[model samples]
Target chain A: MRLLKIIIKNYKLLDDNFSLEFIPKGRKNIEDKEFELNQIDDNLYTFATMAVIGKNASGKTTTLEALAIAYDILSNFKIKHSLNEIKNNNKTISLELYFYYNKYLYYYKTDLGYEPINDFVSFKNEELYNCFYYKSYSNDIFNLDKYSKIINNTVLPDDTSIIYTILNKITMRGLYYWSDFELSYDIDKIIEIYKTLDTNMLSVVVNLLDEHIKDIKRENNNKFMILYNDNTQEVKTKKELFSMLSSGTTKGLFLYIQIITAMLSGADVLVDEIEIHFQRTLIDNIINLFKDKSINKYHSTLIFSTHYPELLDLTSRTDNIIICKQNKKRIIVENMYDYNLRSDSIKSKKLYENYFNTAINYETLMNLKKELMQEIK
Target chain B: MKYLIMCEGPNEKAVVNLLLDNNLLIFNRNDLLGLDIYHARQLVPYLVNLINSYNCSNLKIIRIGDKFTDKLKIPESIKHIIDYKQILKCHTHPELEILLIIDKNLFDKFNKEKSKIKAKDFAKKHISLNGHLYDNTTQFWNDYFKNNIKNLVNDIKKCKKIGKNKKEEIYLADLLKK
Candidate 1:
């Protein structure tokens, strides 16, 4: 169960068409190298870590959020709207996701359009899965016989998607999004899950947290709290410990916990602003945790939006890079390898700098500076 | 055989492409790949890794240069890598080859009286000269390609009035035509 690609259209900053591939295509070099996904089947060339980069307000975060939308829709997480409403726009919102589920590739597309007359966009009325096969109102319209082996005469709710149905049938885990200072209220359940985790996972979290946290244990009151060394003043809550650590270290610990948990559950995780308050070395190390296929045992996938160009230096495969550039109102997503296509092992930092220096134009900034100079004169 | 035209900069790349386009070279467009190297010292190291890693059955690499005089200084830095001496011994793979395409002005620098002798010696020693380009400019390349200059020394003598000295750039749109 691995996410191969995601294509989003008419969703916020991801207007027009935006597509991302999670697998490297064939080329002179860095192409034939394949990633083994948990040894479930050899020769699977899926990327374990995917990084999205772009200039500020170029929709890097929006791209990750759009993925979160798809995951939420699949997991049936309630939202204010079926899809985020476009500002005074009636364009159709579509999310197409391609994932390998149970060794079979499955493409699930969901589209939502705003109804001007009714002044509302409802999921019930909109046509969902506008592809070859579809289901509506808890009924399978096409290829019901094909899914009989898994569904076993179980009928799902009308709102439940075939993707949701298929995901329930296999070990295909949904995407999990993490942020800074996010405290899960279900800490007891996490503690239970973490108790089963290897000691290496706990140590990784502690070591990344400036060595302040000695261990994580359950308190006498049946609450999960991190045990900090006595040299540090006693902290009453998780927030106190989080406050004590630098923003980068705190984010690292938070992400480490989420990643370890996700790896155990065999889930794919999406992160927005992954490089916030992190040093280049720390960012590289965090990315390597997911990029290194050997340590990524469960084949858990990580898709993150980052501003740190230095993170690019850590990537071995060119296809793992997705560059998002703003072309007027629309966002253009490009694969880094397609631009250079060099067989030489050029550092990603150099490639990224080259792309911006050559492919991208900063004429607007120069013009603005000139305009300000003229005004001063 | 697949050809990898390893060169110092864009001007050499343009010349190689021009020769390949005019059918003066022994290879076709599909059989050739170009690399614009920034550091000359890393050339052999890069080539060795490229050749060893290449999956093709038949791949021949040609090292192109800006001047015949440049080949006289084959630094110990490049010789230390992959043993330039052992290139002839290894024949299982398409052998690493060299083709120095330079300006006719370089002949004058090497001294006109001994220029032909030096050029022949470079060729015999596998040090230089299979192509003589007329300066670094697209106009020079365009004329050289259009006229179909097969012989290096003859072309260098004929196309003396090439162009104003400037960095040469390949016309990507024209080159894209199969």
Candidate 2:
């Protein structure tokens, strides 16, 4: 299943009626098969990679969290676990998600209400539409008459998604999400999951990030053998291994392993702060892995956020880049495609120059300088 | 409806902001396309993309510049979306400094020596307020016209009658409300 678009309202810090599209809106500049997939229809295509970029505390993490929540609701059918992770005073959140499954486009709309006292999320209203990809593309998919309303206001469990009822019978595709703060807790899980996959790529990733490491081998269930150029060390815990290996190697190993596994199974991977702990070239290599059609045959999507705007130069299309900005306490998300940049334009330059008003404030920086100088005096 | 008021330079931008701030212009801040005046000479692809991104059908492009010799051309990408008729050019010629010259009551003297000295150089030498000479900065223009907005409006109106062909060109005063 591939996500096409999402419209979120009253969700965390996101602006009301905030909408994001995963597909190219108007003209398709680059025709590379790896850049986009034509699984649904020849005329319709979905991006293989999408990036969210913004200043600090500008809701880049919140945007990713929201996407993760929507993904969880669609894939797991349980909002209870995801709701616990998000803290919002808003009484209700509304989501309208569009995805492609089994040659059919499914439009799912649900209004979820949060009860602060009970600490529970209940579905207030739900609606589902199943339509043909072509018909929905040519006409307004929201027009109920054009499509079949398979589910409407159906009563379900308070914590369960309405999609669970429709997709329960069939096996659904998988979605992998890695939050920025999940590294410490995910290290052990990454090891356990990595043990099942091929170790050749992990060795290559480790060698690329850290020259000291010769190889990393999983000895058994609990222990890992790190073969350094000078010596070898066997560690039972990830903490000991992390102490020996560079942070870049450990994080790169974790990220590369996930990317490889996701590619193998054609699962969508959403990563937050993709540039952290890794060099620019390594980040470029990770993005190139998804863009290379030969390796990523399943068209698995890689969506991530980054503080470095230079990394945006890797994306060929503007639509694949999402710019987040804060306005009056609401987070406004805009697609770079709407900004009408030339295909050959340097995206990083525009971002660094604050062309989109996403860069840090110069006045604030000067104020900090003054405050620091006064303290020094 | 969306109005994209594109200024030629920072000085023109400041003048537009002053008019908008004092509610002396026909279009308010809310009527602007991007909530800011643009300064690009041509319709840049980014600006065109912003216009195309909007779902609104009625969008007018207003170009505020000192010179209109070069025609404003919409890129081919958005030609189907934005028609040539939607674009309006409001010239501040012979130069934007003409505003400073007129505001200083030196237009008649500058006109006699116009062939010898340009309006910009003339303003730099002649136009000054409280012993501070005009430096052609946006801040200077804002300061010079902050209290004399009515005079600035009248100067724009007076300059509209000098040397310009009313049939072919639109002036800054045309953007002001009656």
Candidate 3:
């Protein structure tokens, strides 16, 4: 299943509406550009790469966290551990996600209210069909006609989501969402995927780095050894290299493994602060890989948040870059495609500069700096 | 009929929408496109590229902005662009048609009297044409579309064939002076 769009509302600094769109639509002037484009249908096309740009605390990370939380809710069939802690007071924290599973579109919306009591409400639609509809703590009111005719009138407690119970029955192994982490926890899985992939392709990626990683082999006791270019007899454990290698090398390794795992699993990946601890050139190469259709043959969608302007510069399509900004008391999220811009004349760098330096955003930065100073005192 | 009108910001976008609503400007389906850029400097390179992309003599590019003010700062990235008309009038692509519209009091920034200012001087100048100079762009839009739809239509009619010849610039200059 490929994730398309996510709408997050009233969560943390994201008190207002924040949405991310992975697909580009309604453009009559699409030409062959540098980036690889995936055809959704006759007219709609989307970029595999997505980058989020914003000032600090402007809800860049919050947007990714919302997706991670939604994924957790779908994967685990339960509420996230910190959902209550982050939800706005007395307001409904809602999340709406659209995904393409098989050849059908699935839309899922959830509303968690914190009024008299914390309650969960959900509505899901498969294409034109209603999959699941549940509200409040009602008994046996779960509607699943459009979802599955065979499972009608199933009694689900308010605490349990209808989708959660039926998710196992559905084809959900293809969904893969990752939160940005320094340590690569799925090292074993990464090694498995790495072993199956073409050795030449692995060499191409490994050679891109200065470390010149000849290969990564899994050893005993959850430790992996990296073979370097020295060729003489130098093998370093992953733990030993953690202290010797630059932060960029470590991040590049994790990013490579994450990309390989996502592609092999045919799952959408959500990463926050992707440009963190990575060199500019390495980040550019990673973006190029995402843009290359052959490399991402499975069309694994990538949604990442970053503050790096160079990363934004690498983006060619308007829909590929999502902008997050803090308004009066709310966060407004918009993509290049939202403007309905038809020409390549509207470059990403210009838009990034215009957004970051606009008077409203400038004032936001100034006020934020003042608050930081006050806290320091 | 194929034209692009890039507005400075949201207020100008409202002005364009108002013009379209009252039939001040005529469009054939997707023939018209509008963009809202925060800085006039940001529009320069885009205008340059548009001029080169579609070399059609019938293609018109209209860029509307507020009256050029003395205090406004231009970013260094587009410092070479110099004047707004510089983008409209590309040396390599003189056939590139463009209509540069500014608000009233355009002469105020240049320290020139409105009546004494000749459109020919502006033809050589690269300054941004001002929209409603004295009033804000939104108020000017309201006053024009709400009160004088006929005159707005006439100005737009004159604007349609504007970049085809230099005479339209003088005509527009005289009309804006009013």
Candidate 4:
């Protein structure tokens, strides 16, 4: 299944009526075809990778987290974890998700409300529409009344997603989500999971990041042996091995393994702070892994957030680049395609120059300097 | 209705802000998308995106610049979405500093030596606000005309001779509320 679009309202820092589109809009550039856009139907395509970019505290992580929650609710038939994450006093959060499955476009809309009385959150309202996929239909598939309403306000489990319950009967591909905080906690689990799978690519990734390591071998008792180029080997626990390796090498290894697994299963991989502890070329290679059709036969999507605008230069189409900006505590998400950009203009240059108003505020920096000077005095 | 006012430079931006501040323009500040200084050619994608985002049906683009020779070429990517008729140019002939010269009642002196000195140079030499000389900055122009908006409006009106050329150019006075 491929996600086409999602509209989130009153969720976290996102502004009301916040929408993100995965499909291309406006005039189609023939050159964009060379990019990794997966064709779902005739003339209908979804991006293989989407990059979320912005300045510090501009809600890039929030957007990724929201997508992760949306994906979890859609595929896992659960919103208990999502409810637990809500710390705000907001009464409800509404979401409208569009995805393609089995030659059909499914529109799933739901509202999750916080029950203050019981200190719980549950689905307040739900609706689902199934529209037959067609190239000519384009955006007309969004017209709810014109299509078949398979589910509407049906009473179901408070913590379960209606669409997930229905879609799970057929089979739903789960999404892989990773954040900076989850890395340390999931390191051992990820190592165990990697042990069951192929270790050749993991070794390649480890070697690519840190050339000092000649080989990495997982032993019988969850211990790892690292062989240095000088023919020195040391046995260490999972935590010790991770600590012994550079942070970049550890992250690169885990990210590569996750990407390979996602590609094999054709599931979407959502990662926040993807540029942390990695070089530019390493990030570029990871993006290309999803873009390369031969390597990614299942058309698994890679959705990641980054502070590095230069990484956006890898994308050929503007729709795949999501620019998040926070103003007055509200997060505004805009697709790069919505900006007036010259076909030949460098994406990173525009971002660095504050073309989209996503640059850091000089006034804030001055205020920080003033405070620092006062404290020093 | 949505109005996108594209200034040629910071001085033009200051003048537009002054006009908007004094409620001289027909469209109020709320009707404005923004007061940007991006050139018309470079602003196509931004404008097209704004139109798409706002779903603006009655949108007008008022280009405030000294030079209108550079035509706005709507690329094929956005031609169908934006109409060429919606774009209007308000030229500040010669330069926008002409307003400062006219405001200081030095138009005759500047016109006599127009061949010798540019209006900007003449304004820097002659015009001053509260004993402060004109520094050729947006802040200077804005402060110079802060309390003298009526004089600024009159100066724009008196500079009609500068727009005499048959170049299909509109003047700043034409934007004022009739």
Best-fitting candidate, scored by TM-score: 4
User: What fraction of native interface contacts does model 2 preserve?
Assistant: 0.00
lDDT, candidate 3, A1-377, per-residue tens: 55666677777767555776666643423222213356544434556767777777676776677766666555555554435544444455776766554444456666655433554433332122233323221122222233433343666555445555445443222233334443556444445556667766666566665456675555654465666787633456655655655656555655676677667765556777876676655555556556554466767667788766655545445667677777886777767566666554435556554744322466777999999999999
Clashes of 4: 2
**Reference contacts preserved by each model:** 0.00, 0.00, 0.00, 0.00
Off by over 4 Å in 3: A28-36, A42-44, A74-92, A112-161, A164-204, A222-224, A234-238, A338-342, A346-349, A352-377, B1-178
Compute the TM-score of each model's chain A versus the native chain A and list the values: 0.72, 0.88, 0.70, 0.89
Worst 10 residues of 4 chain A by lDDT: A169-178
Cα shift from native, residue A35, model 2 (Å): 3.5
Q: Where does candidate 2 stray beyond 4 Å?
A: A33-40, A87-89, A115-120, A135-145, A152-156, A169-179, A229-238, B1-178
CAPRI quality level assigned to candidate 4 from its DockQ score: incorrect
Residue clash pairs of candidate 4 = A340-B45, A340-B46
A129-154: candidate 2 lDDT, tens digit per residue: 88876743633434446568884466
Interface RMSD of each: 11.7, 12.8, 11.2, 11.8
- Summarize candidate 4's per-residue lDDT along A106-129 as a digit string, tens digits: 888888777778766676668888
Winner by lDDT: 2
